[model samples]
Target: MWVLTQKINEREDKNFSRKCLLCRLQFKGCRADYLSHLSRLHNMQLGQPENLVFIDDLLNCIETRLESLHCLFCNKLFKNQTVLKEHMRKKQHKKINPKDTEFDKFYIINYLEMGKNWRQVKNEPDDDDDDDELSNAENSDRRVSVGNWSDWEEDEDKVENPVVCLFCERSSSFDEIQSHMNNAHGFDFTRISVDMDFYHQVKLVNYVRRQVYMGHCPYCDKILPNRRELLEHMSMESHFIVPQMQLWDQPEYFFPTYENDSFLCHLNDHQDDMAELHLSKKMEEDCHIGSC
Candidate 1:
């Protein structure tokens, strides 16, 4: 009986290490340590059923982790049940039992292969007109119009210089004004993209400025005189507009203008930091691939 128990312990020890479903990190430890690692890294809670579906290829000895926490309606993967529920609520993902097997196969497989091919081509030397040809085709087919500069001329004329902040009634450079707005008033213009037309962009900036200056809560329709008081009221009442920028249609037209110059500068810095972090992580996980 003691010899049988020893054999069972040896078998369990050999298969002790398991790969995390989310981050794909192979962990070798006791159950408590593994659970702690999962909780710390992936924010996975105990007693929560992680519906991970695994398929093994016996010929190749390869195990593939199939995505199970995905919305069939949207075809989007979620981190967990809480996030999935939030996404379902926001996107209104409803059940549509349409026969989409063929469509799904073509879209999922062919599209992924096409994307991989495109990435490979993109990484190669600039020796062909493939990119230009694709860009021209896309531009020719796109119907979205970014409004002309003439349409926003009237509003531009209202301020002495294009860089003046109407909220604080301060005249400064575009960069300074943007920094001031972001730091002091919580006006995150970084969220605004270059896809927005001059008219809408100007309107959005002016609207937020007006709201902050007037101490008017658009949600609750309350007017307060004090700035501090208004901020408190807004925090308590959750009165704020979520700015949504349209997708970039014309990549060539999207340049760093005086309006978005500061935001773009910050964005570049942020992207650089992310790239460095990603490189470091890749280096750390270089030898740990396919250990499961």
Candidate 2:
């Protein structure tokens, strides 16, 4: 590990010797990686001397009591600047904050940690199982019986502007509703699964005022009552694998077709093998016979 670290450090240093902006060295390093290292390791050492003076000036900016500046990740307020500075170097804050607009490559990690103390509050086995049961019951109530999940209500209300999925109508909170829409109903997930990333973020400023509803975890089949909790769970574990519709190629949403003998469900194992072989041969022929 030490050897690998040293090699990485040497490579990084050589790269830094290039045109790395943070290092200000004319070596072959990239600006992005250099900036990331600087931001993580030497935030206070950045901007200008004037900026450090500005942060120092912020110490006096408070109107009344001298409460220490808050660390953005943990939201822990320190009594002194030294402690706050030290806290920045700890593993708790080592993870990137996607919330920071300036750092483009930064992301929210430790999704389990992102559960926001909810895991601690409800770590008991019975409580977790109860949560899962409640979620299943709710899903059963809201599950659309239509052929296509997206098409169920889209035809009537398909407008130019994006709206929340019909399933997300029960979400009383704005953030939860948005997450639901993005996860379930936003994309044409019939052909392919949507990327589970949120480009926009809304603060949980009014979380206490808003009643968070429970949602089913796409993996492990657990239930989480909070939207953030669900997102964290998704990040920690595989909620949805990339759609495997291509592996068992039939139609887009083709399940084992039971209606007809020609369809997949009615086919025996030997028939399935023959069908696959035919498909492979056809694919090979297509590859050979390229468009003229």
Candidate 3:
């Protein structure tokens, strides 16, 4: 899918940084620190810090809302600030609502994808998550290691940027991930692509990635309780196969299931080579006809 780059909305004042509007003079110097505080303390993430614009204004808006005894996530009004705080804490409503497009202006993606909101980009027919943190907060009952503020900052990057095997937790760099998938999981994406178009291959990979990540069997509806058991079930049941096209074929699959899995970027290059080969054969055929 071709994105019109020149048309993406422009953002400025990215250097703006000041004291946290919510906290008592915390995060006074760096915006990155401010963002970490929000994520760590409040569980609030207004998208990624790097992709944010007018962040101070965004925080001010949120603070104003809070000062009025309102919940940021639900936007529900309360009789007092103490009541609102309790409501947000009890309901786990510390973050902004993803469905609310009013907050879209604060994110750079809304501008970058030709003025399309990031949510819209996910929903667009050409490309898409239930990618919130709350559901998989503990990585589906994995042991939790409570860490310091710096550790908390590092954890988010690791979670979003992992290049782990689709069937297991083994990780490698982007260049090595495909090889790992093939060697470790017996899943060779390139070999499978000889019979399918690029987009179909994308979908198939996404289907498996999602199912296996969620601890479910991609070939069937059978669900496992966790990643460990799911791996065993798939291996023992011999149930790895392309799922129903209707299930996996989606625009959202065009996106990497993992944020930094640059293997998805490699698929574009793979398709280009096939197209080049086809063009070369056609050119040779034309040359022979001309000589004749």
- For 161-274, candidate 2 gives per-residue lDDT tens digits of 132322333432223444664566442322231221111000110111121233654334467876767656756674433323232222322221112211111111233334
lDDT of each: 0.43, 0.35, 0.64
Candidate 1 lDDT score at position 7: 33
Best by lDDT: 3
Off by over 4 Å in 2: 1-29, 39-69, 99-292
TM-scores vs. true structure, each candidate:
0.25, 0.18, 0.40
Candidate 2, pairs of clashing residues: 17-27, 18-26, 18-27, 18-28, 19-27
Ranked candidates, highest TM-score first: 3, 1, 2
Off by over 4 Å in 3: 1-162, 173-175, 252-256, 269-272, 281-292
Report the number of backbone clashes for model 1: 0
lDDT of 1: 0.43
Task: Count backbone clashes in candidate 3.
Answer: 4
Tens-digit per-residue lDDT, 175-273, candidate 1: 577677666656556554244433344344444555555676534547888876877776665554433333223333233223432222111223333
Look at candidate 3 and give me any clashing residue pairs. Answer: 9-111, 127-251, 127-252, 128-252
